[model samples]
Target: METLANLESFVRSAETGSFSAAGRRLALTPAAVSRNVAMLERNLGVRLFQRSTRKLTLTEAGERFLASIGGNLDALQAAIAAMSNDHGEPAGVLKVSLAPSFGVAYVMPLLPDFLQRYPAIRPEWHFENRAIDLIAEGFDAAIGGGFELAPGLVSRPLAPAHIVAVASPAYLRERTLPADPAMLNVMDGIVMRSGRTGRTRHWTMRDAAGNEVATTMRERIVVSDPAAMREAALLGLGVALLAVPDVLPWIERGELVRVLPRWYADAGAISLYYPTRTLMPGKTRAFIDHVVEAFRRDGLAQRLAGSLGL
Candidate 1:
């Protein structure tokens, strides 16, 4: 019988593509991950991975091993969950990944209450703009905005995210407000890029006639961080296209003014996603339930609607 610890290290290292990354998730050192995998390889008497300077590729033997053991591993996890379910207490470390701005503005504030409720569960949070591979990255859950989701993940809607075009009061005072999407081409605009893809996202909007249009404005500044973009817009650097929830406080305080009111971009729904598995850990399940209930009770949608003057 394979030891659970060795099996876990093997599975995580295989999925993450690097021992260093797997180690980070497992709270082990790279050398420890390597040793664990080496032990597994010795017991099985075959090479699992083909290691090279640039990448780690699974060998035929490794692929077969993973296919054979994947279900057993899942069953083991489910069995553990079943055993722990009797306790009826959320106790464990919950690792979550989230979009930087939304995590800071909305989720972080709510976490204090959650932590207080579940004192036994320690939460580890990571905020980034890039899409995370939940299973491979060993994240228990992820909170994100936008529609595109990878396969084999279950997503639950958290809240509706509304976005609008905004500029500093100074910028609006000097330049004529763009009446339509076509006029935005002549103005300096800020664009956001994906850290992994290195491609700038085009702003999606609708005209007065309800025609869907995609516009990529000339970029005076390209920022990877959404918070930095908001700051730049506040400094009158350029027109900023931002999520309404993210910029609402600033707009309410008159630091920024909503531009192109007639043409508003559709704000994508914010969702919490996790790997599709038959059994979810108690802590993860509890956290998701808490988030849903909190958002419902807080009237987040109503608050957002009021902010947008809708």
Candidate 2:
């Protein structure tokens, strides 16, 4: 049988599309990954990848090889891990990706309790706005919304990704508040440019009564991050469309005020996403269970919807 290390290097390099990226995930040098892959290719007697300075493309043989091996790799890893140590207690780096503002505001607080329960599992959390390739990047799980579900991954609903118009109390001192979404066209708007698309996102506002209105406004300042947009709105610059979870604290503190109370944009449901595996790592399973239970207990869906009469 070929070395497990060689098989791992082959699989990681294939998933990430570059040896350098695969090396980062595997904790090896790019040269090391390349050498292992080369050894694997030699042993298998097939050209696995077409390498270029700019990109790496899987060869026909490589595609076929990956298709055959990809499904079983998780099982193999689990078997090896179980053989190496105690199988009852999960112990490993639990890598997770999260949307920064929402994760910090909500999920990060739950870490203390989670860690206390699963002390053997160490978390390696990344906070960012970009959609990550969970399997390719070696992430155990991710929390966010709007990511296209790739093959071999699954998502569980967490809460509605709701955005509402908000501004600082000081900013709206003399300005008249709009009664309807269409009236927002004349207001100074603080908006976010999509990180993936690089375009300013428009809003589709809905009321508690189920009335829908799509509106676009003149942007006073455009930011790439949600936190920055909240800051801009706090500075009394303009009205900003933002995730309710991101600005909930500010609103509660009376530093910011809701522009249209009943109106919100339905951005889709935020979810916890992970790879579908027969034998999931214990750390990952524990995290999912704990978080889902916590959300359920706290009524996160309704809270995120500002149902406490916020």
Candidate 3:
């Protein structure tokens, strides 16, 4: 019979794509991890990985086995660890995906504290903007907005995802402030091209009186990333629609000011998404709680949801 240690070694190697990395997570030498995997392969009479000096690629059988057992493996281990209070600490590699800008600005700040509390957890964070197939890609969790709910995942709302028009003070100087979003048509407009849609983004802003105003600014500049759009506006280029989380620091420092102050687009909630709540590993659960508490401490929901004074 195959030992649980061999199964763990195999799964970690498949997920990390390297024996060295799996060994580091499991606190074993790379040679030892390799031997465990080799033993498992011999017992099963199948090759799980294609080995090369550069990288390890999963064979079809390896992929199938990983898919079958990966989701349940952590929960099972965590349960056993919990049976004895002295060994209740969750210890494993936690792979997560996040948007680069948001992750750096907000989520990264909270990580130090999370690490201090959950010293046994090892986090592998990937910063990206594209939508990821969590299970197919072997990610433990992801943070973003507008993710379509997949078959076995769950999402917990962290903060509001609101977007508003903003520009640098220098750019707005001597220029007539728009009375409404419609007046932006005549202004120099810095806009973003959507990565997902591959088209220029358009905004429909809502105001306090429950009135909506769709912007029709001429695209003086079309940028690809949210950071670039913010930078363009800062260079006195034009007004751009931007997310609060991306531009909040700049706005706080008075580097940027909101246009049409009362109007914002409610993009939805920026949520922490992961595998099913019931099966969530302790590391991921700890991260979710830490993030939510941080947001609550800062009253981030109010700030992002159009509650700020101009």
Write candidate 3's Cα lDDT for 4-96 as tens digits: 889999998997899988876575789999999999999999999999999999999999988988567787676665563344676678888
lDDT for model 2, on a 0 to 1 scale?
0.87
Q: Whose TM-score is greatest here? A: 2
Name the regions of candidate 1 deviating beyond 4 angstroms.
Answer: 10-27, 37-70, 146-148, 169-179, 183-202, 207-209, 213-225, 236-238, 302-310
Better of 1 and 2 by lDDT: 2
Per-model CA lDDT versus the true structure: 0.80, 0.87, 0.83
User: In what order do the candidates fall by TM-score, top score first?
Assistant: 2, 3, 1
Model 3, C-alpha of 208: deviation from truth (Å) = 2.3
The superposed Cα distance between candidate 2 and the true structure at residue 11, in angstroms, equals 4.7
Tens digit per residue, CA lDDT, model 2, 1-310: 7888898888989888999899876757899999999999998899999999999989999999999996578778878665644546766788999988878878999999998998999899999877687876778899999888999899999998888899998889998899988989888989888867899999888887878999888987999888899999999998998888988889889999988887898889899999887667778888999999999998888878842336
| Cα error of candidate 2 at position 75, Å | 3.9
Pull out the clashing pairs in model 3.
none
Tell me the TM-score of each prediction against the true structure.
Answer: 0.76, 0.81, 0.77
lDDT of 1 at 206: 77
Better of 1 and 2 by TM-score: 2
Ranking by lDDT: 2, 3, 1
C-alpha lDDT of candidate 1 relative to the true structure? 0.80
Estimate the TM-score for candidate 2. Answer: 0.81
